[model samples]
Target: MTQELIRATIETLEMVTVSSLFSVLLGLPLGVLLVLSRPQGLRPRPALYRALDAIINVFRSLPFLVLMIMVFPLSRLITGRATGTTATIVPLAVAAIPFVARIMEQSLLEVDGGVLEAGLASGAKISQLVWTVLIPEALPALVNGVTITVINIIGNSAMAGAIGGGGLGDLAVRYGLYRREPVMLYTSVAVIIVLVQLVQWLGGYLERRLRRDGKVTASA
Candidate 1:
């Protein structure tokens, strides 16, 4: 039981890490596009923004359980298996993409409009404006978003056990539920809670560090 719990913890971490990375990679760009396409955005295209917004909303609207099943075929096609730790990565990422995109959109939008205007006035390209001004300005908030996303991914990964996605959730189900081991169930829940607290602490630490560094840099 000890060994299995350890393994399950590792699997859960792997799934959460990989899925969050993919979410940021794809969702960050989508979010940038979403903001840029907004009516008051850098490039303002209402139609494009609306379309993108709708797509994100549709995906976000689906329950994670349903989304997991819905993506099984795609998972099979990509990972060559529809259920397991690795295969679960696909659905986790898909579920997180829209979520991360929205997080980034909100973070980026919070950047001071004056900064964006100044970048524009300085003849900076849109890419430059984003890379230099917007992202930097919103770095702390973006970190917060990432932290939230990581926690959410961790939670979803627990649910992934329903389909044999190997992790603490699966371990809990197999032994705790199936074998009727109350100890295993309670232990699994305790471990998950501990993991979440650790992640939350780490994220808060990073955000505070970033904010402090940004302040120092600006003052310098």
Candidate 2:
């Protein structure tokens, strides 16, 4: 049981971490594009914005369970198999991309409009404005958004396990549900809760640090 628990924990962490990283890598740029291409943005293109918006909405609307099944073929192509912790990263990342993109959009949008204007007025290029003003101002919000995404991924990873993705969820389904081992089920649930709480705490800590640093920078 201990070995099983350890293996499940490791798998769950790997799935969540890798998926979250890739999601951020892809989603941050996508979110930025969504924002910049929107009406009255850095480079307004109503058609492009609408297209991106629609695509993100479509993916976001799909339930993760359905999305997981839908992506099996792609996952197989990417990982050479559709089942396992590594292969699970494909579906998980696909689901998380739009999820994180929406969060990133909201976070970036929360930045003060005045700051963006100042950057523009100062002859800052769009990229410069984003890197220097928009992102810095939105850093705290972005951190919070990432925190939320990570927690969501943790939950999703478990669900992935339900379909043989392999994690705590797999253990729960295999032993707890299939073999009638209630203890394993309960233990898995507890572990997930603990992991979430720790993530939340760490996120809070980082946000506070960023806020404090921002204040210090401003004061100086």
Candidate 3:
């Protein structure tokens, strides 16, 4: 039982890590494009902005469970199976991309307008401004956004188990619910809670450190 729980825990971590990596990779660029293509932006494009915005909204509107089922075929196509941790990552990543994108868009929007103006005045190209000024200035907020996205992903990963995507969630359903072992259920729940708490603490620490460093940089 102990070994079983540990293995399930590791599976959960792996799924979360892989899905988060892909989500950030895809979502971050979409988010940057979203901001840049908005009205009054560095490269405003009303048509493109509206199109992207609508697509994001459509994905975000779907419940995770529905999205997972809807994407099962694609998941199978990608992974050759749709009932394990690796295959589960496909739907998880799909659901998460729009979420991360919105979070990033919100965080980037929070950067001071004056800072962007200064970058422009200094003759910074759009790429340079985004890489240096925008991202750096928004680091603390972006960290917080990542923390939120991670927590959300963790929850969604558990739901993935309902379709045979194994993890602590699978353990809970199989042993705890099916076999009527309350201990197994509670243990899985406790493990998830602990993981979330740890991530939250780590995110807070990083955000604070970035803020302090930013202040020091400004003072210098």
Best by lDDT: 1
Global lDDT of each model?
0.92, 0.91, 0.91
Against the true structure, what is each candidate's TM-score? 0.95, 0.95, 0.96
Tell me the tens digit of each residue's lDDT in model 1 across 108-137: 998999989999999999999989998888
> Cα miss at 82, model 2 (Å)?
0.6
* Candidate 1 deviant stretches above 4 angstroms: 213-220
Worst 10-residue lDDT window, candidate 1: 211-220
Give the Å error, residue 9, model 3: 0.5
Flag regions of model 2 displaced more than 4 Å. 213-220
lDDT of candidate 2 over 118-174, digit per residue (tens)? 889999999998888877888888999999999999999999999989999898889
Number of clashing residue pairs in every model? 0, 0, 0
In angstroms, the error of model 1 at 64 is 0.5
Over 93-148, each residue of candidate 3 has an lDDT whose tens digit, in order, gives 99999999999999999899899999999999999999989888888888898999
lDDT of 3: 0.91
Q: How high a TM-score does candidate 3 get?
A: 0.96
